[model samples]
Target: MQTRVLKYFLTVAELNNITQAAERLHITQPTLSRQIMELEKELGVKLFDREKRQMHLNKAGVLFQQRAMTMITVLDQTKNELLAVNDQLSGTINIGMVESAVSDFMMRAVQKFQEKYPDVRFNIFDGDGDTLRERLDQGLCDLVALIQPIEAAKYNYFPLPVQEKWGLIMRKDDPLAKRKAIMAHDLYQLPLVVGRRNIVRDDITDTLKIDLNKLDWRVIINLPENAKQLVLSGKYYHFGIYGVYQKYHDERLAFVPFSPTKTTGHLLAWRKNVQLTPAVEKFIQFVADQTTHKKI
Candidate 1:
C-alpha cells in the first residue's frame, strides 16, 4: 500500500471517524472513504465496521494498526536520520525543560548550539520535572532538563553544568528574610507556594514529612514567575530551586537558602533511549565538558 494510503488509514483509526479524520487530513470525506475502500479491496480484508455514524476497527484492522504504527515510527526516524546525515541539521529538536533551567542555562545552550549550527531548529516545552519526564516517555520531547533524581532504568542521562539548591523566596520586608538560612519547619509554618507534585516536590515532601493539614500552604503555581509574583505580595512563601528565584532577587524579593540541616535539592534526569542526532550528541558533549571543568 502507498504510504499516503497508510497515513490516511492511521489518521482514520486514530480519530475513528472518517469525517473527523478528513478534516484533520484536510481532505474530503468522500475522498477519504474511497481511499479506505480501495485499500481494503487491495488487502482483501475489512478494516472497519461502520454502524450509522460510528466506526469501529475490525480484528484485522486492530492488528494492522499495531504494525502500521511501528512502521510509521521507524520511517519517520529513518527520514530524520537521513536528513541529519545529509548535513542538514535543520530538523526540529523538541525539548522539555524545567522552569528554572530555561531562564539562563537552557537558553544559553540553545543559543550557543544554534549559533554554531544555524540550520538546526528547536521547540521548547516547559513544565515541572515530573511532567517533563512524562513528555519524554511519550515521545513528545527529544530531551528534558530538570532538577530531580531519575529512577527509570531504560534511559541514560548526562549531568548539566549547574547544580541546584532549594531556597525560600519572600518579600524583602518579610520577617523570615532576616534569617541567613531557613529551615523546613519554618517553611511549614508559612503559606508555601510550591510547584505541583513532581519528583522534586516528592523528594521534599518525603524529607519533610510534615502534616499537610497543619501547614498553611497557599496556591501551587506552575511557572516560577507567577510564584515570584505571589511571594512579592508579602503573604506567601515561594519554595523552589534557587536558580528559578535567583533572577527575581532584588530589593523587592529576598531569597534565603534552605538550611543544610533541613534538606537540599539536586538536579538529574532520565531520557529515552533514542539515537542521538549529531547535534544532540554535540550538545551533550558540551554539557559534559562543562560539568567536568567545573569539578576541576
Candidate 2:
C-alpha cells in the first residue's frame, strides 16, 4: 500500500509493457517485476493477464486501478496542501479545461493572479468534458472548464460569457463553403466528421431534428488536428464549434455557421464540498472578479 508501489502499479497498468514502464520509471526491469509481484502477494490476487510480451489488466486489476488513481490524487493534493500551509499565497493549482473561446479570459485571470502571488504555479490539463469531470471527481484537479448541459447537481460552477457556435468546417472549394450558414438538410447524405463524444451527436440530433443514423458519419475524431486533416482532404465536413476552426484556420478550409445558430455556453466547475487550498481559492476568486468586469 505504499504510494511508490501504487505509482509503479499504475504506470505498468497504463503502459502494459514491463520494459517500457520500468524504463519510464527509471527502475530496472527485474526490480519493477519484483515490486509488482510483491504487490500482488500483499493484495492476495493476481492483477495482470500475462501474454507474450504483453500484460493486460485482469478484473481485480481494473478495480484496483480505479481505487489507486483516487488514492494517488488525494495524496498529491494533501502533500500540496501541507506544503502550502506555511505559505498562504503559494501552492500548485491543477485545472482541467475543454477548448473554448473563454480560454483567453481564463489565461488572463491566471496571469493576473500569478502577478500578485508570484510563487503560485499552475498545471493545466486538457480533455473533453467527460475526461475533465473524471479528473475532478478523482480529486486530480482543483477546477475544470466545460461546455454546457453538465450535471449541475454534481459540482459548483460559474458560467462564462462566451457562446460557442456550432458549425461546419469544410474545404474552401466545396459548394457549402459559399453559403453564409448551413442547415440540417444541407448536411444530409454528406460524409461528415465530428467529436467522438456521444453527447455531441445526440445533441445535434435533438437540435436539428435530423436522424443521425440517416447521415453518413464518415469518421469519429478524438483529436482536432485529425478532424481538420480529414476535412482538408475535400471529402468530409467537420462538425465542430466555431472557436476551434477560428483558432486554427487553414487556407483551404472555411467554417460556416449553422442556420438556426446552435450554440453552447462555457462553464468553470469545481467539486462541491471539497476543501480548497488557498492558492486555488484565490485563483477562483480572481477569475470571478475578472469575469464580472470584463466582457469576454
Candidate 3:
C-alpha cells in the first residue's frame, strides 16, 4: 500500500468525518473518499463503521492505525538517518519517556545536546514503560526513559540521576496533608487514585502492605499528570511518587512521602541488537556522560 493512502486513511480515522478530513488534507472530498475505498478494497476489509456523519474505526482499522503510525515513524527516522550519515548531525532524535521527575533531568541533557549540535532536533514521546519500550523495540523510539524493574533481559540501560521516592499527593487542606509522611493505615478505606500498571500497583501494595482492592480506588490513571484534577477535586489522594507533585505547581496540592521509605529510580533504555543512528548514538552518549556526576 502507498504511504500517501495510509496518511489519508489515518486522517479520516482521526476526524471520524470525511468532509473535515478532506478539508484538512486540502483535497476534494470525492478524491479522499475514493482513495479510502480503494485502500479498503486492497486490504479486503472494511476499516470503518459508518453511522450518519460519523465513521468510527472498526477492529481492523484500529490495528491498522498503529501499523500506519509505525510505518510513518520508521520512514521519517530512516530519512533523517540517511541525511545525517556523514556526520555533522542534522537529524531528529525520537526519545520516548514516562512522565515523572526523570523529565527534569532528560530536558537538561537535551538542552546541552542542542547547544553542541544546533542542527539536531528531537521528537519527545511520553508513555508508560510498556508503551515506551514497545516503541523502542519497534524502532520508532531511539531511547526510552523508564522507572525501575525494567526488562533487563531484553534491553541495555543506564540509570538516570533522578530517584523516585514513593508518596501520595492530596489537597493541601486535607488533614493527612499535615503529616510529613503517610503510613499505610492512613489510607485505609479512603478514596484514592493510583496507576493502572500491574507491576507498579503490585509494588506499591507489597511495599505498603495494603490491599489495593480493599481500599476505595477512586480513579486509575496511566500517568502522573492525569491525577491533578482528581486530587484537586478534594475527594481523593493520588497514590504515586514524589515526582507527581514536583511536576505540578498548584499551591492547593501537597505530596507526602510514604513512611518507611520505598524508592525507585529512572533508566534510559534502547534496544539491544539494533544499530542506532549517529544522532541517537551521540544523544545517548551525552546522557550517559551528563548523568555520571550526580550521586546515585
Ranking by lDDT: 3, 2, 1
lDDT of 3 at 258: 90
Clash count of each predicted structure: 0, 0, 0
lDDT tens per residue, model 3, 62-109 = 999999998988998899999889848889999998888888788888
Q: State each model's C-alpha RMSD to the native.
A: 6.3, 3.1, 2.4
Write one digit per residue (lDDT tens) for candidate 2, span 1-296: 79999999999999999999999999999999999999999999999999987999999999999999889878877888777776557879999887767676677778888888898888888777888888899888899988887877989999877788898998999989999999888888999887777776678668878766678888886657757777888988888888788766678889999878889888989999988998888888888877898733
User: What TM-score would candidate 1 get against the native?
Assistant: 0.66
Q: What is the lDDT of residue 163 in candidate 1?
A: 66
Give the number of the best model, judged by TM-score: 3
lDDT of each: 0.73, 0.85, 0.87
| Residue runs of model 3 more than 4 Å from their true location after superposition | 50-55, 211-214, 294-296
TM-score of each: 0.66, 0.85, 0.90
**Residue 63, model 2: Cα distance from true site in angstroms:** 4.9
Model 2 segments beyond 4 Å from truth?
A: 10-33, 49-66, 196-214
On lDDT, the candidate that comes out on top is 3
How far out, in Å, is residue 13 in model 1? Answer: 18
Instruction: Please write out the lDDT profile of model 1 over residues 141-172, one tens digit for every residue.
Output: 67777665656576677666656777788888
